[model samples]
Target: MRPAAAGTTRLLCLAGVVTAVGLLPWLSGRNPALTVLRARSAEQEPTREALDAVRRDLGLGAGPLHLLGDWAGGLLRGDLGTSWVSHTEVGPSVAAGLQVSLGLMGAALAVALLPAAALVAPVLVRGRGSAGAGAAMLAAVPEFLLATVALLVCGVWLGWLPTSGWQGPEHLVLPAVALGVPAGGLLGRLVADALPAVLDERWVELWRGAGVSRARVAWAALRRVVPPLVPQFGMAAVGLTGGAVAVETVFAVPGIGRTALGAAKSQDLPLLQGSVLALLLLGLVAGVAAAFTRRALLGPALRDASLTLPTARPVRTHPAIPLTLFTLLAVTIGWGLLRDPYAVHTTARLAAPSWAHPLGTDGLGRDVLARLGHGAASTVGTATAVCLLSLLVALALGFLPGVAAGAADIANALPPVIVGILVAAAAGPGTGGAALAVALISWPPLAAHAAALVQEVRSSGFLTAQRALGAPRSWILTRHVLPSVAAPVARHALLRLPGIALALASLGFLGLGAQPPAPEWGLLLDESRAYVERAPWAALAPAVALALLAGLAVSGAAYAQGRAAYDQGRRTVASAVRKEAPVGI
Candidate 1:
């Protein structure tokens, strides 16, 4: 297919994805308002009919496919439906939120893109030490921490920007920058990495040797350099859009992100769904437009009708630490089989670390070591469950023609918090609930990655030969595509671990994950807040553990990614058109 045609096809497929994902939250049978009505009107005869009406209106009573069709058809006809909690039309509120968010996205993206592009020229010219290091360091800073620091200094200390709700465009400056700076730093690092490779391309060397001016050579390289960044930026756009929720909550911006968060907190289905759909549309439209722009810039000479770019060089590093972490986790899980986590030590209440309790004791006198061990078991167990479930489901989705990636993209576009909140609402708070929440949010990228690999391998000469020889679909997948998918899947899974860990931790911290008697890292953090000054070990142990674990996961992921990249480069270029899945929040 032609480049433009393929871009359009992909865009159309993503529209289908939007439809699939937009219906996902409503597929849950929970309706808080209806539950309230039932409890309130238990003595009334009309309650049953009212409950049925509420369920039907929310599409909870129908099959998911039927619900999707009904909702999507209504959306096509401009019927946005009324809020289940407020009874207000969702359309106007969504429109206003959309405008504010788009503006914020524009400003944040500009804040990110401009600095990145500006820094790119110098980084390319000066070599990758100073600017590259700075960008990488900035990229390493977490979004939430960045936002918190920005709010503290800019809002509280300096009193320059308001640390509260949306008042005017002026109110956006600090929050936008807080969000944009890290995003910009991320983009800058990508550009920095690409510039070195682009400059080293044989064509660039030939141009330089042919007496082309440095300025002209740089200009040509920059143009080609930007084409690859478009897709990366597209993926980044979704994460940033999702990430805006954290910033929105921190800064109290009344954008769609805030709306989504509020809806999630209250289990407000209509508002949540509408706000999520708007974010999905934003990402879908932005990604398509970016992809098309990349297509145009690539031109015929560069693109060969498939819109594929030169894949980056193999990235590799050692996996020792991460592997060791896994080994230790196995030990922890095994220990859980023998240890009793709930045995209380009342005499040791708020006790410091001792021979008996090496990790100290909580105010409740629970053995922190045992609790931490149990927490590790639970957290790792939940993470493992999420990973396996996500992969199984994603692989199945990957089998569907074009739809898997589209749906995955749509799923990826929605914020993780929104998805997690809804999934948790449906399942209720517990280990299983958190696993389902994380699994639902995590699968999209895996699905997208798997789909890309499947599509790439489907074009191989041998694969075609097998099909010509009448091999079964299942046989071909099991024998051929399945093996090829392993490296990429492993790479993506490892890379995603840190984020998943943090997300799980965040859930626990918020009291939405494992309840009391659970030593989950986030819950430990929450529980230790009051003891920070006196019994610092209460918080420090878990915090330090989380950081070390995150570091190991990142290292392991880096090594896996590098190995995948190296192996991919050794394959045929036509078979090398696989995409790097974006790390989900």
Candidate 2:
């Protein structure tokens, strides 16, 4: 954990990313010269002389290793090379996109603090803090879904702001709010959940007893509550920009996320690499900032106090929420399945909803309801498979630590969109590619959680006693270690399913997954974009379904977490009673 070692690790990771980006042309199993030639002049013949000329022009004649070295060297010299598609300097475009993205993210961060502040305001005024259920629910909604709804409600319905394009201040409002609201809700929920525990601490009691002002105590509590959340905030930073892929695409904001997606689609390696590098750096900088902020907030005294920062408990919600969501989704799917999704009536394209077509028809006149039902299996089912695979990978890597931890730390900085781009380059775009991309980035959170829990469990007195009694590592792990870790980690993974689905949807939206006529939610949204103004119903069905699915995941996870806690509490009480009971009794 020394500063020097950290710096070296970061440098190596940067080099690795650059190298990988450089080799993407080779990894993709496609002719780079032909791709570049097609991008430059699609009508040209693919002759040996022309291919050789293109290869020479791109410096690919020197081999991949040299190209990688050239890329690394250029990066070191503050050069981003030139785009094959546009034949322009990639640096300027990357910089412009990054500037816009940074500005958007900054505004979004400010907006995020609003809800966090709102959550804390009551605690400052009153004595206790409540983790608002609304905040938790809001946090569960995906950025793309939120962006779609914001566009529908604010732009299309209310006509308060422009729906798309990055023209002026007006365009920023919807995207910022779309990105910020969920983030704010998450931040507020984390702070609020941790606040009660911090306020109940002995130090807070002593401070209040000493006649400290309520404002000062609340401020202190906030400080204590937030340091532990630096990691979450760091991830949130990544989410704001990385999640911006869909948001940017939706709003037509020329941010780095959109740039990356476009570059991937066009096979513009230079542009794609530059955009990905920018995003990767953003994540790294956010992590550094989080660490620095955590230290600054703690100061020397508190940093040395060995304080165990309060962990936020999951938000408890009424069981009815999940039940209602599940029922609604089930009914919708069941009703849709009875209809044919692929039946195209050219005359009825973009038609309004009728008894025959409950959710209306898409641009191809394909039944929206049927597509929704059919798409569920492709989107949700794929997400479930990805989540399960991620869980298994997390378990394997988490307990192993060492190299796994180091690799996770590096990969944690990678956005799912960036991973999708790389995966698509290597394995072509499809549902499988999107699933693989999501699975690649999804395991880090679970792995980190499991790793931390494993470390804690391994060091416990009970584990020590079991070890002293000659218990095998496998036996101990299965009997004690896994039992303690599995439930919490599984619950964590469950809460993340919606995000996984969203990522897949984002990929599909970017044309990196589930091609035409697929009926995948993201792809459906993409297809509906052109005729959305004429018939908004084409877009509404999939957007609403995605949002509803997110809500279901959140509420379901909350219900399960609450039930587990209740069961644990009951067992604890029963154990205590048994311990205190008389021998005869």
Clashes of each: 1, 0
Q: lDDT for model 2, please.
A: 0.83
lDDT of 2 by residue, 428-538 (tens): 788999999889878978988888888999999999999999999999989999999887888788778877887798888778899988989989988888887788998
Which regions of candidate 2 are displaced past 4 Å? 1-15, 47-49, 452-495
Model 1 TM: 0.71
CA deviation > 4 Å runs, candidate 1: 1-28, 34-79, 114-122, 127-142, 145-164, 167-174, 210-213, 295-308, 315-374, 393-403, 425-430, 441-495, 506-518, 522-550, 562-585
Per-model TM values vs. the true structure = 0.71, 0.92
List the pairs of residues colliding in candidate 1: 315-562
Mind giving the per-residue lDDT tens digits that candidate 1 earns over 1-585? 334544455577657546645565455545564653544455655567877776665557667677778767768888777776677898888888778777887888877876676667686676332243345445544454456556655776577878777888778888788778778877876766666666767898798789988888878867877887788777778767766776776677778877876766566656767887787777778778887888788887777555434554433455675687667655644554455667886887878988777767877787766776778767876787677777777777665635565555555655565555556555555666666667766887787778778889999899999999999999998889988886667657756766677677766654557877677876776677555546667665666566556555655655666676766667856454444444461
User: Worst ten-residue run, lDDT, model 2?
Assistant: 1-10
